[model samples]
Target: MEQTEDEGYHKLDHQLCFPLYAASRLVTKCYQPVLDELGLTYPQYLVLMVLWESDAVNLSRLSERLKLQSNTLTPLLKRMEELGLLTRQRSKQDERSIIIALTEKGKSLKSEVPRLQQQLMDIGISKEEAIQLKGLLTKMINYISG
Candidate 1:
């Protein structure tokens, strides 16, 4: 019998994107419990991590760092602001720009980051494998972005 189009290809197993999507979801799932303890969602945790690195940055700069659109980030930032985790203000140099700065409450969460990172150590992958995987993924990201 001649194989049909669906039978010959176009299956989930044949798509490279499927496993990448699944792996990304599963990795995010692994962060759930730990994130709950800190009262953060995955995206919120990401915003905090970025701010921890650079505390006062403009919204456009933040959008670039997070690789998220301003529309998507606005509500997230508003919620974070309401939570007192961060604050947003109009920049003196440019009123058009919103500046984000971690509040004292947000800065206090920095101490718990090691606990969050411990989740990675608990995962089965060895340090070397994790590093290699991150490098490859980063390359893929750069290539796609470039």
Candidate 2:
């Protein structure tokens, strides 16, 4: 049998991964302006979301949840602390670990996030579409991670 040179080679247009990567980057860029107004970066916004859901998470746990390394998270957390958005204190029970807690300012920002996120949703996707998109993303991530 004759074989084409293209067999087993990669093609950008046909790759599902590229769309996921591109969409992720674009979505992060879209969030940048909204987050900037709150004095936050996309990663910081992610941290805020995690902390908003549960306020006093340990450093390691936050890093794991956010898929960040301790070195990277440490600086980000420090910056958040300097911005008066959150507080970092060494755990009294285990001095080796640190606890990150949202400050009043950070807690107050939660109300504004819904409005900002809604704006993105309204412009980028409908509510029903967004739910379906979320499910699709979850499935993709789970499959890739698995």
Candidate 3:
């Protein structure tokens, strides 16, 4: 059998993953300037967000929540610690585990997030569309994760 140009498998646009991959990168680029003001990379920002929501959590818990491996999160956490944004220490209850907690500076970053979110919301789409998109993306994530 001969495959033609119109074959679904041959077109980039027909692939389900490309759009998600591109959009993820584009959204991260949009966040770059905003995160730069805080001297944070996108992954670091995500870590702060999770820690901001829960004051202290063990490395394993954080890894689970962020969908990252401990090895991946460790370097980011170390940089944040060096920057005085957070601290990592052995957990009292489980000496083998490390707990990550934000510093006052990290906590203060919460105030800037509202403006960042507002800027993201104003990115050429209606609020309703944004909400629908989030829902759809979340559903896709859940399906894939399962």
TM-score against native, each model: 0.89, 0.84, 0.90
How would you encode candidate 2's per-residue C-alpha lDDT over 1-146 as one tens digit per residue? 24355763365776677888998898788787778787788888888899999877999999878777999998888998999999999999999989999999888888878766754764566789888988998887778656
Candidate lDDT scores, in order, read: 0.88, 0.83, 0.88
Cα lDDT over the full model 3: 0.88
Q: Which residue runs does candidate 1 get wrong by more than 4 Å?
A: 1-9
Query: What is the lDDT, from 0 to 100, of the residue 32 in candidate 3?
Result: 87
Q: Where is the poorest 10-residue window by lDDT in model 2?
A: 1-10
Which lDDT tens digits does candidate 3 get at residues 1-146? 35577686677887777988998898888888889988999999999999999878899999988889999999999999999999999988889999999999999999999867765765777889988999998897788777
Give lDDT: candidate 3, residue 120: 74
User: lDDT of candidate 1?
Assistant: 0.88
lDDT of 1 at 24: 88
Give a tens-digit lDDT track for model 1, residues 21-132: 9988988888889899888999999999999998888999889888899999999999999999999999998989999999999999999888887766766788899899
Off by over 4 Å in 3: 1-7
